[model samples]
Target: MKKIIITVVVILIFAIIAIYCKFILGLASQMANPKVSTLEKEMSWEKEHKLWGDYDDYEKEDYIVKGLNDYDLHVTLVKNPIPSDKYVIISHGFKSNRYGAVKYVDSYIDLGFNCIIYDMRDHGENAKATVSLGQFESEDLYKLIEDTYNRYGNIKLGLHGESMGAATSLMLLAKKPKVDFVVADCGFDNLYDLIHTSYSVAKVGFVLPSVNTAMKLRYGYDMKKTSPKDALVGNEVPVCFIHGEADTFILPENSQVNKAATEGYSELHLVPNAAHAQSREVLGKAEYRGIIGDFLNNIDFK
Candidate 1:
């Protein structure tokens, strides 16, 4: 009986160890080469459900922009005929490219704002497939902002980002804090929570902590360094946080926490029955446009 008990204990220990190792390895692999398959899935769902709204006709210019650490980034410049002094930079979520946010181009363009959309380092037309989330991608956005300013001569700037892109935009604001206004939609407050939630949803238990440890080991910064909550705290920039009430991926509370963290002008809009980026879909095109238009109009874009 004693021998059997010892054997059972040993088996349990081995099982735990195996699970930990597997989780760490999986996370490391994903961190080294973040896949955009999830983004593609969401996009396919949106298209099948006819979620995206009609976009205004605009000329699209494809160009290669310089990224951080000598990496080249790809971007699509959507220009409006009016050519107003205001510019809006839109960033897509994880595993998504500029096209994912194309539905928003027309609204901003209609308001006489030049819209610039770009692919992150690993996703879209970008050459690399590795993503450190927003750790490194934030630098690419900063460069794009600088390029925009240099060319357009310090025009009023607005940033619109969803999910990972939203996190990246918040980090940019923390690092620079110069944007006239920001709209963060369905973004996670902390990277740790996001990783844990994602793994849980995938039925991969015990992977979150292991992956987080490996991330810290591989890169100097942990999830806290990439936290939008930390970035938004005490920030004086005008920010609008739009969240879906039924969002399970990142949870609506994440947006609430981030909204609370902002010390300056901030507003939160919880879409009643929406899920993740489904606010626009649930609210319909006209209502969605009106909400965003009202938010933009309320901000002093000087």
Candidate 2:
């Protein structure tokens, strides 16, 4: 009777562990596989925020750059009519496409910069694939940067990214790419904490560790290792970190943390009452543009 009871308890313990692991894997899968918005949804937001000019009217040059594993990255170059060698590559947030990054075009152009806005993998025109959160994203953008130099030839380059893109921009510092400056807006410091904060799970101590294991098993990347804060170690790239003060999602503290970690000239701006990726929308174009301009001036980024 005692032996039978002990066997049943062991079996129940194994069953509970299996159930918990299954749940953790589900969360990891959901986190990596996000539901991307349609082009129409992306364009509508672009149309709303891009109040000055019609995006369709720009001198647009499109291309398909090769990203990690030779994935096709849908890219577009919006040329400034003023004839300048300056360029700014803009990376949009998760679930958003190149069109979603249109709001920043006019501001960059006004600052005498040609804009290159591209769709990140699994978002926009690119074919569906596993999102690395920001692990391979930094490498993918590095590929685009290399291609940009090959195509444009001797151009003054800069980077501007929002949310995931912001994290991507900062993470690329690990490669030590030759870019003039980086403007990171509302980016997370790392994926693990981001998932925890986003889901607001109560038993995170029990939940996150299993999810980390699942992330490695399923996605070929570790959530704990894929961190912007770690990526900033010894990176000397001039970065302007912008975040919304009221952003409970990514939290304003992320920018503060990254600012402290960055080895280069770094600045943080927390927009009052702005939530998540709404810093530019809340600050207005002029104020937002001024911040970038001021950063460039402070860095002497000519």
Candidate 3:
């Protein structure tokens, strides 16, 4: 029995080591070679759906923002014709671009808010294809907010981000609490939980340490730093978290976690019979718009 116990312990140690090595290799592979699929490429169903829009009338323009590595990051901006002091920065999710959020631009514009929609790194017109989730993308948001303030001059800023973008917005608040308000839709509370969800969706066993290790190696950031839970805690900014009750991608609990993290000031709206980013589609535009309008009316942007 003693020998059997010793063997079991030895096997567990070896398994753990093997998993760590696999994650490290995965991270190295991602960093050594970043790959972005072509905007025209339809690699998967999700990719195809994400690319199914034309922003011809959106009138896209480019802006170069200075980055930490002296990289003049390029951002595509879509401006509303009717401008106002209130402005919103919309961030798209993983494997998606500005077009994905264009549908909601009018909602903000109708409220007399000018919208600035931009593509994240390794996405859209950006010259890379590696997604660090919100690990590095959060910096993009910070830079954009700063640029907006410089150009527009101390305007009331609002944020709308979906999935990975939502996570990025939360991380941005943790790093810098400048935005007046935030709307996070279907954002995962924890990076570690997100990785586990991905694995579960693929019918794989949970390897929490492996996912955490991979994130650390790829982004040079730990899970704690990337956690929306930590970011939302004690945040002064009022956040409205919108999640579909039927969402399986990030799960509604993730939004609840964010709400709990932010005290009672943060609001969570769970749309019934909706599924991930489909709240508007499921509830119809009028109802969806009304919900957001009510939230905005309740908040004091001053």
64-120, model 3: which lDDT tens digit per residue? Answer: 775434444556566666656888888887766665666566566557677787777
Models sorted by TM-score, best on top: 2, 1, 3
- Decoy 2 TM-score against native: 0.92
Lowest-sum lDDT 10-residue window in model 1: 49-58
The C-alpha TM-scores of every prediction are 0.85, 0.92, 0.80
List per-candidate RMSD values in Å.
3.6, 2.2, 5.2
lDDT of 1 by residue, 192-265 (tens): 77877787778975767667677777764576577888887668888888888988787989889988898878
lDDT of 2 by residue, 60-164 (tens): 999999999899999999999889999999999988888889888878887899999999989998998888768888889999999999999999999999999
Off by over 4 Å in 3: 1-60, 200-203
Candidate 3 lDDT for residue 212 = 59
In model 2, how large is the Cα lDDT of residue 192?
83
lDDT of each: 0.78, 0.88, 0.73
Q: Is candidate 2 or candidate 3 better by lDDT?
A: 2
